[model samples]
Target: MVLVQTKIVFHVDELNKWPEVLSNVTNVLMDLAQHDDHHIQMVVVANGDGIMGYLIPSINDQISELAKTVEFHACHNSMVSHGLNSARIPSGVHIVPVGVIDLASLQDNGYRYLKP
Candidate 1:
């Protein structure tokens, strides 16, 4: 038997409102992973002010549960550039070496990209 999984990467570069992010991520989780056992692999890569979304409790709390299963990556270089630190990045998010590089590599690896 062949096992196939869907790989998706969502890139959040700007500080988007929580509604859009929550809706898209929830849709991916609810529509893809929860509804169908299609083996969904998802990631959220955030850079710039976009990282703020992960810091705020109102936003972070909403998705904290999903973080247990979903991959949430923050950009180390972006944090440095923005004068922010990883300590403020919330509990479940990880720090990638660089956000843009991470995005490029994911795309190269055949992950579909979404900007919401």
Candidate 2:
């Protein structure tokens, strides 16, 4: 039997959307886990003000929990623009040169784009 791969990239650009985005990520993972025919590759990319969520203790903890099942990415451009440094980023989160470009590249490679 062949297992199909489903690639999904979640984009978050606003700080206020972290809760919703996290909820959506949890739901998506749960929904997909019920099926065995597909292998999932999920990524959450935060840019703009959304990267600020990583500095908040509460949100950061929540993200760290989900990081075990979802890959997390932060935009270096956004961090620099907001005067944030690598030390402020939570563990398990990757630093990307640019969020928009990364999103485009993922989509071009057949990963579905989701903004929540």
Candidate 3:
């Protein structure tokens, strides 16, 4: 059996430009998915206004499809602080307890870190 391992951590804190950041991150993620690196995951730690901005979806449909190959994780701490629940997260979003955890686990597994 082959084990696919590669992770990306996105620590998003800024509120204003987060939307654009998320969109670009989505693009890179899609690119990774389509590339030889088939196993790619995205851990998005959104705090403060970052939560609102991180929800943007990728533009290209192929990117959206490729996104399925990537795991999208949201920081639960932000959600709670923002008074948001799993229901509040847009479609295709996964909620994690915190970015710290996302880093410890996913990063330990060879996931790269991205600020956007």
Candidate 4:
């Protein structure tokens, strides 16, 4: 059986309200993945100061749950600039070479972009 999928890449470039961002995005993604016909694939590319959101202690469990649906990525370049090392970032968040280029490639490959 063939399945249709909705792909998404959420790019976060600022260190805005981390909790709200994840909460809102998770709500929207869960709603999108509700129907059997819609197979939602999502990844959040966090760069700049936004990468710190994934390390919040209050949302550790939420991040764990989010990982089940959303793949979280951190920008290594941003990490260096922000003085953050891999040892400090959460385990589940994958560290990519560059977040902007990754975001661009995802868009080029047809993943819808949301920077919220």
Candidate 5:
């Protein structure tokens, strides 16, 4: 059997523009779902002020549903600083210790790195 992996890391921590980041994130996820043929693993490393941007209902829903087909995660550090509980972020967004590490490890294992 063949194992296929599509790894995506949403690095929203480095941006100052929340709306633009949200827009781009949603679009990238949508494109990934529509274009990919193998298994997808999506990890969102939301840090800094961008945490609030991902709390949008529409974006959350899109990502939540996509989680059924893709692995989803958010940085616990960001959740703490933003005063957001796991319940507040999207339903399928898993909490991770470090987003950068997660992304790096996945890439090192052969998952592609994409930033939109």
Candidate 6:
């Protein structure tokens, strides 16, 4: 049997889309759990107004739990634009220099892009 690794990058730019994005990530992880031959690498990149979601206590808690199994990225540019400093970001989430550019770089490195 051949093993396959799937890399996925999820882009979220709207605050309201956080729930949907979380749901999508949960579903993907569940689906991947059943497939023994496939390995998954997932990252959720938040930019634009979506960065505000990180400031929400409830959402941050949820994201913190999920961070154990999935990667989370916050855009530095967006954070600055929204008046958020690095200290405001959750513990496990990474801060990227630029969201769109990071997305492009991930795609170039073989990660499939998903927006919800």
Off by over 4 Å in 2: none
1-116 in candidate 4: lDDT tens per residue? 56777788887777675666687767877787576666877888889888777667766677787887788888999999888999988878889999998999889988999866
Best by TM-score: 6
Q: Which pairs of residues collide in model 2? A: none
Candidate 1's C-alpha runs over 4 A off are 1-4, 33-37
Instruction: Give the per-residue Cα lDDT of candidate 6 at 43.
Output: 92
Which candidate leads the pack in lDDT?
Answer: 6
User: Which residue pairs collide in model 1, if any?
Assistant: none
The positional error of residue 78 in candidate 3, measured at the CA in angstroms, is: 1.3
Cα RMSD (angstroms) for every candidate in the order listed: 2.0, 1.2, 4.4, 2.0, 4.0, 0.9
Q: lDDT (CA) for every model shown?
A: 0.81, 0.91, 0.64, 0.81, 0.65, 0.94
TM-score of each: 0.86, 0.93, 0.64, 0.86, 0.64, 0.95
lDDT of 6: 0.94
Give the clash count for model 5.
0
Residues 29-87 of candidate 5: C-alpha lDDT, one tens digit per residue: 67766765555565555666666756777666656665665566677777787798877
C-alpha lDDT (0 to 100) for residue 44 of candidate 5: 56
Prediction 2 global C-alpha lDDT: 0.91
How good is model 5 by TM-score? 0.64
Off by over 4 Å in 5: 1-8, 14-44
What alpha-carbon RMSD in Å does predicted model 5 have with respect to the real structure? 4.0
Model 3 earns a TM-score of 0.64
State, as a TM-score between 0 and 1, how close model 6 is to the true structure: 0.95
lDDT of 2 at 42: 86
